[model samples]
Target: MFGMRKWNTPVLRPTAPFIIGGIAVFYLVAKAQDAMINSEEYKNDPRNPAIASGKKAH
Candidate 1:
């Protein structure tokens, strides 16, 4: 059969892995960004306020 499966068979679609992986990557990125934002280095960086105020940092 060309890409045909019996009604009783269970199939794992290809998008399942990609969907899970995308969620994992999103979670990790959010955690990293939170850490970076909370770090002293970020707080002391003048560019942070400047960016927030919509001013170009020199």
Candidate 2:
């Protein structure tokens, strides 16, 4: 009589969490940048005299 044995394997790599965390961080940064760019405060800042004088260059 011949018998076969099966082996169970476990995941040894710990890269999934790091990849997911990096993606989440990237999304958050992009979202924050978009919000800042679209905000009125950023568009109407006094530091840039051009914007305050209503002479935005295209």
lDDT of each: 0.70, 0.68
Score every model by TM-score: 0.55, 0.52
Q: What would the per-residue lDDT of candidate 2 be over residues 1-58, giving only the tens digit for each residue?
A: 3465476444435677888899999999999875665567766666655556776633
Give the clashing residue pairs of candidate 1, or none: none
| List of clashing residue pairs for candidate 2 | none
User: Per-residue lDDT of 1-58 in model 1, one digit per residue for the tens?
Assistant: 7676566554457578988999999999999886675577775576575457765434
The number of the candidate with the highest TM-score is 1
Off by over 4 Å in 2: 1-12, 44-58
